[model samples]
Target: MNCLKKTVLFTLLLLGISLSAQTVRKYSNEFMNIGVDAAAFGMANAVVASTSDVNAGYWNPAGLLKLEDNQISLMHAAYFANIASYDYAAFAMPLDKESVVAFSAIRFGVDDILNTTQLIDDQGNIDYNRISLFSTADYGFTFSYARALPLDGLNVGVNAKVIRRIIGDFASSWGFGLDAALQFETKSDWQFGVMARDITTTFNAWNINEEKFAEISGAVEGQNQELPETTEITLPKLQLGVAKKWVFHYDFSLLTEVDFNFRFAETNDVFSSSFASMTPAAGVEFGYIDLVFVRVGAGNFQNITQLDGSDSVGFQPNIGVGFKYKGIQVDYALTDIGDQSAALYSNVFSLKLDWSLFR
Candidate 1:
């Protein structure tokens, strides 16, 4: 740790704070309170702009585009608060001279819920609140193909995905979606990127053949009870971001980068929100001769209610690190909202072990 490097990193921290001033005076919500898959949520989710690492696959599949070789990654986070847990495993390999192929499986779901429904006959009867954990799960498998077209320094890629969700005693649904990403890196160190996801609205429905719900109709039971009509909402999400990576001015082993993102989508059980945006995130990594990395950053819209004493909330600080080995990669991240927001969160960890045949 050099003094000069620390000073520069501190300066960037100040700038991040200034950006925060402008982020306020907007809005807030609950799904935003629901912690994401990992502590990696620790940072402003600076993961997408990250390069040469497998975690990038989750944040931005296009990240695999800059890889010098083929690789695989696995990640899991123990969600302490809810039955929810996050797990993902993926593989990325170059298919041809200008194409890359990737495969991955992702899962996140609530465990069993207390099945406390009182039994009743066609005749109206009353029952006490029951207690038993019901079953539920959601998993999706995806394949992504990316290419670097030789078009005057312009790089582009496309990724297609399939998603599935299963509700206990309810109908399950599956659908397809696609994403596109484009980037540019010049003779200088400046780099720029743009991406769009969930181009198609993915849908799911409950109470079909697999799970049947008997409708109970009794004027005494209150209103025409239609076992919660199977609803439809768009999972179609969209986000756009730009990044800039700066070479170290003095510390040759270190490099720094900053990114800003704007997100838009409808509400879901996953994250409650009308919209989300992260602007001007900054971080610096003290690299140990290109073998290891120690990084820190701040800023991302967070629910202030998540914190205890503070009546204020929206975006917080994040810290993370990574270790890379031949055919093996590991990553970890941490987020701090403040002491007022005492609810501790789980850590997000991911690993990727891949092999390339025939050199």
Candidate 2:
């Protein structure tokens, strides 16, 4: 927080904004919105209203205020036939009786891509030695803080993030954004949550190294292409969710949740679209005395009957199970990607550690 540091931060922020202006597009960074962790994804990301763990910082930061203990969580996912991987790590600590803070990081990467170039000889034969490998990756770091409001059962929170994207070694970009959220609960176990992501709109500045492109082109003939330098902008999105809990049979309980998502883009004017593009999601969880859990959910349903020729209305499904014991928890989930040609399934595994047990 010194003057020099502040100056550097401001410079970077301005650079990102200026570069991203050239190539800004609606929802340019959708990957950041993809839910992480098996439990959240398995519940169709409906936990926004009722989340109470470390992952809450990512889904609904206000939910972090519900935690009474320090905890850490890690998750790894295999996506799209193992060609890509996603990982998340988070740590949450209570600042006081009514306030909490958390730090989290996420990474998504695709590796082992073959870098092919044209052969120098005219025999039309490919040179195996000329082929190399490269990878693309996206990274994000989030710092969040939450506190209970003076109103009973009400909490508010905020998240600040730094983002970086890399493509092979030739291109890279930097970005930053802010998020705000609120959560409310009633005596009847009814909960509501609202979140605004990228409220100020995130900007990314792309820096392409033309010299690297030239070196690659020089090695291979007629295989070079010019690279475009530009920036990307992500518009603000709103998420609203509600949940209810039903308790019965001594230690058994059923939790149900529903969520609505809205995207605000220059192309999709909110006044005109009304609710046409709102995506609705629902999920259910069956829990036994906080020891074992089963979850199932589906969401992002669209008819597309009149808009497109396809009459298919299949919704993506997710299933997961979890076990908890002595402050240690493990979870696994399988999600359908809804793509016929690509990998049919994506898998996620997560582990959690609650330090309160040791205390």
Candidate 3:
């Protein structure tokens, strides 16, 4: 392959390795793993079988086959006490009565972080006026297509994605991956779906400027600091979901979904992890026809070994509400990460438009 392609692949690999470390800098493209719309967020990401809107571009492409009209959606979230933000946009167009295609993008970042030097001036005092600012950002672009199979109520889809990561102006990496999905529905409105992400073990190659690192970490006397050439790889992940809908009155409905995510990587110990490396989630939604929605969910149900060598489990909950008027829709959600204390919360909002309603 060409030089540019090689660099991107290497960067993708780095993303996976970082995630495995579970540190603040663990994942290079961690933003791509975040759910898009409030619906998915509030549902604890149990959306593989429940996605029917533009958010399907990220959740399960096969769900796009449910859209009869052209649609577009935009969403934004204030993450981690407003220290960072995540944004998403998607558009889906029907290719025929049974097929559809979509394009989407996401950006997550922390901007304008102050950069300072440790050097002290006279009297051992540092100069505050010399500080600079830099930003760290991650981006993902996806092109997805879905089509109904000849078998009744069956659909298949795929996503081709490109990813990029940047830390200030000194280090940046690019990578790519592929995702595949399958969805099926029963005559009683029960749905099942499966998705495989980064099916090819996406790879990322890093190109670092050692000079920038030396500036950040002070230089040693008569010693040269050089960056090392490294490549990162991310293994594929599998997620499965099941959803069911119950109709009460003619105008009211309730939807429930359950999801399980499986990772192939090894963990620290058997006590802190499950046999299959699994994470389970469940969500419920109440709707008034197609005009209003309320949702609640809980997930990230895993055990962790605390610093004191004690095993503990925490609760993470999410809630959301939505409104639809004509062709326009609005949604809002609040997600709580209990493991990170009470203050660690994420707020998400989204808007969607359907072109067919106007015509």
- Best-performing candidate as measured by lDDT: 2
Q: Say which prediction, candidate 1 or candidate 2, comes out ahead on lDDT.
A: 2
Candidate 1 C-alpha lDDT tens digits along 1-359: 33333333323322222222221223111122223323235445544444444444445556666766777677776554534567777777776656677777777655544333333434656553433344445576667666676774456666676656554553455555676766566666555556565555334343333123332123124432344434333333344444454545533355455655544543221244566543455556656644576766665544454235554444456667777666555668765546433445556776656665335
TM-score of each: 0.70, 0.84, 0.86
Segments in model 1 whose C-alpha atoms lie over 4 Å from true places: 1-43, 118-133, 205-224, 227-231, 235-237, 244-252, 265-282, 302-313, 337-344, 356-359
Cα-based lDDT at residue 216, candidate 2: 52
Candidate 2 lDDT over residue span 39-142, tens digit each:
88888788889898899999999999988799999999977556678999999999997899999999987766555533333587777786566666789999
**Candidate 1 has what TM-score?**
0.70
Q: In terms of TM-score, which candidate is strongest?
A: 3
Which lDDT tens digits does candidate 3 get at residues 141-186?
A: 9999999999999999999998777767556777788999999999
What lDDT would each prediction earn against the true structure? 0.51, 0.78, 0.77
Worst lDDT 10-window in candidate 3: 17-26
Q: Give the Cα error of residue 311 in candidate 3, in Å.
A: 1.1
